[model samples]
Target: MRSGRLGLSLGLDLLGARICSFDCLYCEVGATDALTLAQKPYVPAKRLLGELSAFAASGPPAFDVVTLGGLGEPCLNTGMDRIITGCRETFPGLPVAVLTNSSLLSQAAVRRRLALADIVLPSMDTLVPGEFAALNRPHPDLSLSAIRQGLLDFRSEYSGRLFLETLIVGGINDTAENLDVLTDFCRELRPDRVDVVTMTRPGAYAMAQPAPPDTLARFRAALGAAATDGGVGHGPAALRSRVVDHKGPSSGPAASPHETMARVAASLGRRPQTVKQLSVALGLPEDDISRAVEALAREKKIQARAELDHVFYQG
Candidate 1:
């Protein structure tokens, strides 16, 4: 979900359960808490709908978009269709989006449900079969060919805007061949835009690294007019302002170590930010941010990756 100083965007984490089909090495939410392929309602449609209504009635927060995504893949949730239908019926004017990993797009039903969203942001990291397995660590039954076919099929069927996201990890999917395959895939899929972003935040695997600036530039150039760094409108820069709370664990209140860790994790859960950014946004000292980030890293509650000179934390 993207937010800015202008306003915030609410992310409905409907699939609280670990329902993702992939256990990606670069997953920011850490390893799947409960990895499974079963599509069932983790967050009941009625419950989510009721909560939305209640929140609206209580003077709704100033958010511009409603995003459907969470720690787990939103498409894995069986009740997604109902939730999307209710969201459209209840808030016709609000733009609703789904942030998916494209693992389940192989299923026709899943693609149909996702089509209901106003905007669909699906990620396609690599087309190489071995790299797909190494990077995504998909479910035992899932095949790269299936995922590729799914994307192609969905592009043909869906009418909504599609913003394809390609996360470039240094030394892994940054090879010239991989980038070429990615560019070719984007050209065939014909997404409205291609967001070529690097791993600015830490991921589940310790070895996960961000692509170099030169590599990023090269990939963007390959993508041509369809490629963008800041996205069409809701890129990283636009999403970084005024989303996290200013008060932090090391401030006047003097929160406990656990509290500090929780606060840090929660902030990262919202969006990836560097230690300095987190320190400034959360009103904590740089030392405190570092300490919390380290503790979270040790616990595997959050991941950190170096991009340029700054290391960004995420979970």
Candidate 2:
């Protein structure tokens, strides 16, 4: 699917299940089922590589980047190094990008594996310990000092493009004290870019609301040259400057009704979406998307929540 951060991204799901190191309140894929810090081969490298090879050989549509992330953390899969190599080998020219939650970067092995990618996007929601625990609900083994040192070490050792993402939740990390500390930390890490974003979909917690426009603007100003406006209410000019607009995927044969329902279910599993948004992304009509959404809801495969005036479906 197309992403504002990475244009026309072809996602690779290393961990098929919701296995993660942290169960953040703002997780778009709902709550985590298996919350652990163990690094294991949840999905074997050979199987994933075989699937990648098959998909690449099937004459797939154009994609700008190959992203290694899914419903859960990609680094949790011990075969991450092999997957990165496989992705590079399969898609020779496209850049390989990894999206990590910054929980395991303290390990030298994890950092070594991540260095293979062309770009890495690691998140840091807050520097305060209380806020970190309240917002991320990370494993008991993880600490703020360890995570900070890991990021510093990775930045010093790696030469690839590093884009640090900070998710701003209202009444939590948006306070001036937290933003000050976070801004200083960003400067110290010196990432190539910083993406300041907020929740745009239904989060795991009900109180996780998107920050207001004025707060985002203030944070962006403080971040200076390293920040990019990635969330809502950033205005059209800033949006056009920072994001690359794509016209969904290349048009192909129309999918059957059953196929449409399955696609909708899979898409919602990744992130919540409205009917109109799904229609545009899947290249299907509004009526077809609505029908599929209704079917999924009735089957209990997806749930709908009303935010403002629009309804968003999530799996």
Candidate 3:
């Protein structure tokens, strides 16, 4: 492992497979066929353990902060708390982190379960009613206010760090008024840290673009200044590596088309361009593009690294 960006956050997808509750508009894998709460196939748990044990044994501090979010919402996976706690004992004091949509965190049982981990990084994109609906387009059962209070309450109650992620979509939540609203939401919660970002991936909405580089800068400037600075924890740097056997554009479970595309994209290091771009370049439909991406991604064929507003698949 070598030094990389994302401020030294090391990530591992614990589910051994992809499963989730929301088919987010900004999902890099594209539209999900279902909102799944149950787990299914991928790499097995034993395989995950073998890989993790091997990686850690290969080098000390294989990562700084071990992240539980990737591919799909990690919280949706029931074994997350156990996995995080288990890693702490195995790795000893390795900070655990999870990035959730905060969709399910509103449930008291769910919030209580999160306590087993060290840090919870939930997203709160929309503060206003309409903005919430348009941006997050969350499950029909949830609301923006509910999302806000969830973050507040989670931080208030949880002993671990409560970090909030705000994905700043362009022409959507980048307005001055919207920023102010977002600022207030963060202020109320006083999250350990608040990061504003844009959707740089070529996800579902063609309109979903990463916030301007300037927008991210200004957002951090305005909000970072007034916020209470939290203490930093030491972690190993994030590293970049290629999936040796990326099964791009494959069919069936062994290597889905989506994982193949993602594997190729990750090897490329930058977000693959818009699916439209990939479709035109490859002469494929936009709908099927995600399948290709997800398959490749699963195989480590493509990696969706952040740019500015949009996540470009590796060409």
Query: What order do you get sorting by lDDT, best first?
Result: 2, 1, 3
What is candidate 1's lDDT per residue for 1-315, written digit by digit as tens? 322222344567878655687887777667787767888888999999888777666553455556788778898888888888887666667777778889888999999899988778788889988788888888898878888889989989998877777778888888888888887787788777666777655577778878888987887677644443333334432332323353322335666677767878887876678888776556567787789999989999898776546777777
By TM-score, is 1 or 3 better? 1
Off by over 4 Å in 1: 1-7, 226-315
Better of 1 and 2 by lDDT: 2
What is candidate 3's lDDT per residue for 152-215, written digit by digit as tens?
7787788876666666777777778877887776667776666665554466566677677888
Q: Please, what is the whole-model Cα lDDT of each candidate in the order they appear?
A: 0.73, 0.78, 0.58
Query: How close is every model to the real structure, measured as TM-score?
Result: 0.77, 0.87, 0.67
Q: Candidate 3, TM-score vs. the true structure?
A: 0.67
- Which candidate gets the maximum lDDT versus the true structure? 2
lDDT score, residue 207, model 1? Answer: 82
